[model samples]
Target: METAMSDIKIIMKETYSKLVTFKRKENRESFNKELLKVLPQIYRYVSKRLNSAVANGKLNKGMFNPSDFTDQLFIEVYDNIDDIKSENELHVFLFKKVDELLEDSLVEEEFDHVFFDNIDTYSKPEWDAMEENYTQDGDGDFLLLEELDDSSLDKTNYTLNHVFITDEEKKLADKLDASLDKERIYNHIQLVLDKMNLPMRTVFELFTNEGLTTEEIADIRKTTLDQVEELLASARLLLKNSFEKRFLIDSN
Candidate 1:
């Protein structure tokens, strides 16, 4: 995640260029090479999500093996990767597909493997909720909220400084020590973000999570820097206020 946005962009551009420059066989080979290079990062990212999902009770442990399932996903992603325009796009698409597929596969595979053992005790509502969570036509209720484009900007688009992540925010994030509950804070923050409209949420993810610069976010979302700044500022304001309220100012 610490990889700079410019470096990511350069890698994307170079890989795309390589794919288009070669003959049929060479291009396929080149694409495979690029995919191989990124596989470690992808696996680590996917493993983290799978672990989180299992922790959240969204996935059963004995249902489907994650490594094998990830291999299957990599194959599917490889087949579909040609349509992706950039590395970021590929990453976003991969995770979106993973989120959707993980639920279905876990449910269906568990049904297959545990048909006799848990046939009478199957929890349908949990499966239903998990399926509904990723539906494209549903209310945009993303559990991970990684892939999406945002065009809306707040009405009051203030032109703040290009630099974001103020010292206060950094200090708060870093102050996750023995006293504070870091997990609960982030989980609440994500809950708040999930309810937000697309533009602000998307900007927040790119700016804060992906370490993208304001200019990079603006260009990717095809908006002006001021608009991105406003969206990001709005997200920060909401988060900052929410955290302060939750943590309670300890004036000793």
Candidate 2:
């Protein structure tokens, strides 16, 4: 019987300790002090309520675990302890729990607000210097930071500060620069002019006073209509030959 009583005492102490420790990771010294104050209050409240059960041998220490105590507390004061059939009883019940939460002596110090303030306040000059160092690139222009011009859809309207050579133009230019012969180049230019078929413009440039037509050329050359047609055909062929010699004969 003595052994049973001792075991019951141990169970009460262990269960109460577990409730105070459960899910609490704050200051150990403060928590233990607060818990010490809470345990006696809980013991008194439970003991008074279960006096009949204890006498009847129904209320055992092993059955009253930390979870069981928490459950009982929840049921007791859940919808206002005043509704628990007695005013003085509910007052004493809640007063002890509230006292445990608000015990000023148990808390040795307030939260470190100065440490938080120091973290919030930073040196602006130091930040500015660091930003300058971070952004420093020895290059003349920061291409990445260039703003896109949204004003025009025409690609030619945009000017590249650096010489821009397209892949196709670059390749063709490179090949021509390496291999093109002088005669071939000259012929190609003449061929292009011939293809333009602007005899009136040429006549205006060469002899400002004299006006000439295709018929006049035929008469001067002493050719029939059919012969004139053949001569024009031959002229076209000669122009094509000249163009091929000048331009089509590609120089490296």
Candidate 3:
């Protein structure tokens, strides 16, 4: 793991050096070529944000494309890359710019800001009904499950062991963890995220889906590290509580 990380650092350093050289010469072609290497991550972030916004009725699906945002971002990078001092800074700059674009496009008037804070209060039958609905909707994608699994927090595999689990609940959590397939869990998680406010969802996705550190997420969101940490913790706890309520609690 250490070796692989070291190799990544080396590669990033080299990429940065090349970018600097290209910047010095005003070499748009080479600079863009190098910049495109990071576009897949940027594209994925934009795509997810757009999908979420569209899903929640914040945006018209036909009005924008992920590529439109990416094209504008590349222009912004070309003009402002000189201001970036380091490779890591460049990475954060790209996300920050794209986030700004998304926020601007998604006006405040469109936001409903719904949050499902009562997951624990939900009855087992209610959860089961919701689960059945989610299954019928088939909203969860396997790729999303893979992305959630790859996060540092590993919320996808969260067990009741982390919460105040009684012995029975612990056994139930273990049993459910083993029995519940990836798609079901991912679907439930998606439903949970959809109910959360944008900041919490963005923080969770930036950390889990984008593989960004808390500090980077803070920079991207223009918030404090403590706030970012809090959002992430809250998001994870919500997922855990919702999962326990839906699957671990006995339906009497």
Q: What are the models' TM-scores?
A: 0.45, 0.18, 0.74
C-alpha lDDT (0 to 100) for residue 108 of candidate 1 = 23
For model 1, the local distance difference test gives 0.48
Task: Estimate the overall C-alpha local distance difference test score of candidate 2.
Answer: 0.32
Displacement of the residue 79 alpha carbon in candidate 2, Å = 99
> In model 2, what lDDT does residue 145 have?
12
Best by lDDT: 3
Q: Which regions of candidate 3 deviate over 4 angstroms?
A: 1-14, 108-176
Q: Candidate 2 at 251: error in angstroms?
A: 6.1
Better of 2 and 3 by TM-score: 3
Cα lDDT tens digits, model 2, 1-252, are 234335434544554444334324434444343334333434332322232122223344344332234333443344342343433233234433432332321222232334223422324344334224322311111111112222211112111101113564455445544564543333332222222222211222111111123454344333465655554454343433433333334430
Q: Residue-pair clashes per candidate, as listed? A: 0, 10, 0
The Cα local distance difference test for each model comes to: 0.48, 0.32, 0.67
Could you give candidate 3's per-residue lDDT for residues 42-116 as a string of tens digits?
666776676666566666656777677777876898888778888788777888999998888874423233336
Score residue 143 of candidate 1 by CA lDDT. Answer: 25
- For model 1, give the 10-residue run with minimal summed lDDT: 151-160
Candidate achieving higher TM-score, 1 or 3: 3
Comparing 2 and 3 by lDDT, which wins?
3
